[model samples]
Target: MSDDGAHGLTIIAFIGSVFSPYYGWSRAQDPFDHCAMNVVLYGRPGRFAMTERKAGSLSRSQDHIAIGPSSMHWDGTELTVRIDERGAPVPRPIRGTIRLRPSGITAGPFHLDAGERHRWWPMAPASRVEVALTEPGLSWQGSGYFDTNDGDEPLSDAFTSWTWCRAELPDGAAILYDVNHRNGGGRSLSLRFGFDGARRDIRPPLPAALPPTGFWRMPRATRSDDGRSRVLQTFEDTPFYSRSLLASTLAGEPVRAVHESLSLGRFRNPLVQLMLPFKMPRPL
Candidate 1:
């Protein structure tokens, strides 16, 4: 998920399993069996960290997952994130706490197919995030967003490309979700939800391009009502995807947003597959 904090934006993810045989090295039965915690600090090059842990060592009881010094607990009312550790391979020590309280706005567990192969739940379109970083001794509180996505199938098999973004507005928040399926079809959702749970469908503007990423030129774009968008920071840029912080307008309001673009077609490429092991070495 994307977290816009006082210091900067951060993206944390746990990619469990892919059905492809090429991913056999993961040694996972269920895709969620073996997982890794990936933390990306926007605008901080070489500060990213990924720690691998067996799913057995991780506890998932309802809304909490505890593994080592990091844990994420969500009890519907709030989401609490705690991290305390020195990163491997790079040795960057990161210790912090992040708390998110829902603003009472939410979107659907929107299904992409009749069989419900893909779905997303925008749990909190807008929320208050409190931050406390001990290792760096920084703290701030601000607006944040949270969402959850789950699918029965591998993303590369279901979609060719997708772009997603969330914007925090004055009275509420907005989300733009668009995907190009492998069957030459597409789906788009542009929604604005208020703090009181009111929802509106918005007509997303024409897509605008951002600067091409390094090495692979991962395509990145988003819809803005004013036809103006700027990529303020590029967090993680790989051959097939990119996560960025952007400044743009949605529903006639200026917003700073966390944006992401994923190209599953390129992710399926053999060359890209070969590079995965370098960044995701097996856990010792």
Candidate 2:
């Protein structure tokens, strides 16, 4: 997200893109064979690009990851990203560079399901990001968050759905993870991390209701002081997921949070999977 909240971007480097129809059909194949650098720009003339490449187009190391024309590297201090991709369905350019400097990195390996098949890590709960895009010519600096998730089994094997939110507070960042399992149970994780590398599990605020996404109407909400949150902006709204900017009170302080609601159940639907290719095409 931009410092002024006017521009925002999401770049997801995927090795076995969970949303790829190619990966869906080749589940028994090598994960690296179905990879992509998923990029989403949220501003005027917004764009969405995800080009699934073959195994020969992927590379990785201790501090770097490259998928096709885009790559990201961490050199102890700042993480640098280079992007060179074109939007699908119409093919528009989206080339850019992003630099993220984490205020602090945290240690996390939390389980999101009872079977311990899925894990999540809040690598850096607080940071600053600079998004400089040359293709569309947009640039901004803003507060940011970084995290990673991995699973021994497919996500659909464990989670039915989940809601996550990350709010930057005066001192640090607060995050909430609510997960519903396939077997009819769920878990909630509430955590606070300081910009100075301090982290602690905290009592989550009361649950607040918010309006659903306009197109998908995907259920969305957050933890807040009065159990009332409002939608500030809806960034991405797909059949199975929604990302939005939310305004609410947390820990007695008014805060703006980046929230996401994902439904793996919907993702598993054959029709939804078929429709994904329109937005996530694989370029051979």
Candidate 3:
């Protein structure tokens, strides 16, 4: 999962028994379990730093996740993060503290598959972010978001394509979740929720395509209520997924949102599977 604030982004990734043998998964017992951390300071272009540790090095209780020099603690009300970059690979240095308090609205534990193989829970659909960075010396605060994705089986086994986006409104927030499955079926969720914890399902607008990715020709699109959608920034474009920041409207309100598209069909390709090791090298 990742947290994107106004000034920085932090990602905490956990690969379970399936993806353990790669990406520096733990070697102590089951060589396949691992956890990794990444921090990016938006001011420094190309200054993304990542660190990987064995699964045993991570500790996850009810509301806290601690690994190496970084930790995220959620106390049912607010989420707090403390990042220490002294062990990271990049040289320029990056470290910070972040706090996110929910606006009291959430969406789903929504089932993505008919058999309940995959699910999504929008824990904090909209949040107030407070940031304090000491490494390169920066400080700012703004709106933020948090969520979770979980599956009982591999993604390739159930899904072919998906597009998800969240927009923060003046009074609350909205989310559009659309998915296409491999079995010739699909699901769509257009939900709007308020800070007071009221949620309603609405119909989303037509799909609008964004520009294709540079390398893989991976397609990207989002549903906007006004038929106007623009890509503001492309954060990640891989063989099977694309993550971007977009300018769009939801429920008639102008919104700047984080958007993502995943192509499980591409991920199932033999060549894409072969290339995964390069991006996620395992430790010997």
Candidate 4:
């Protein structure tokens, strides 16, 4: 997201694209062989692309990683991402470069699951980013964020669904993670990270249910000060997942946040898996 909340971009490099049909039918060995660089640019004429590649197309170094023609490199001061991909279900060119500089990098690898098999790291809760794209003739500078999540087991085997959001604050960022396990237990984490590298665990207000997506009807919820939140916009609406822009009150202040809801139960369904290939086309 940009400083004024007008432009937003999301990029994720996956080592075993959990949403991939190719990975679902594989023998489950050599996870590295199933990889992808997923990128989505938001605004007028928005674009999305996620094409799973093979290990032969992946290259990794201490500060650099490349999958296919897209790559991300960190030079100690800033992270630079070069995207050269085609939007799926349409195959239109969606090339670009994104640069992110963090206000402060948080120390993490925070546990999510009880067994510690799943983890998350808020590397940069508050950051600044500049995006320049040629394919769509887009350019902007704005406030942004970066993070990483890792899980030893597939999400479907461990979770029923989850809701996550990061609320921008005056001096830092407030984050919430609510995870429901398949076996009936769940956990919620609410924390604040300052731009000066301070981390504080916060007791979240409470879960406030928001209306479901109009198309997919994916369930939605988040926490707020008044115990109420509303969807400002729905970005991505898939059969199993949804990303929304939310207007809510947190810590007694009004906040505009990015929210996501994922239903592993829907994702694991064979029918939904078939639908994903249309959006995340994988070329063998």
TM-scores vs. true structure, each candidate:
0.87, 0.96, 0.83, 0.97
- Candidate 3 error regions (>4 Å): 1-10, 13-32, 38-43, 85-93, 105-108, 273-284
The candidate that wins on TM-score is 4
TM-score of 3: 0.83
lDDT of 2 at 226: 81
Ranking by TM-score: 4, 2, 1, 3
- lDDT by residue for model 2 (1-284), tens: 77777888888888878778788788476789989998999888698889889999999999999998899999999999999999987699899999999999887678887778888999989999988899888888999888887877777878889999989999899988999988898999888898975886566789888888898889887788788899998998989999999998876678988999999988999999889888788766
**Reference-based lDDT, residue 111, model 1:** 85
Instruction: Assess each prediction's global lDDT (C-alpha) against the native.
Output: 0.73, 0.87, 0.71, 0.87
lDDT of 3 by residue, 154-173 (tens): 67678789899888888888
Model 3 residue 103 lDDT score:
80
Displacement of the residue 201 alpha carbon in candidate 2, Å: 4.8
The residue-by-residue lDDT of candidate 1 on 50-134, one tens digit each, is 6656657566777887765688898778889887755555677678888989878564688875567998888788888887777
Pairs that collide in candidate 2 are none
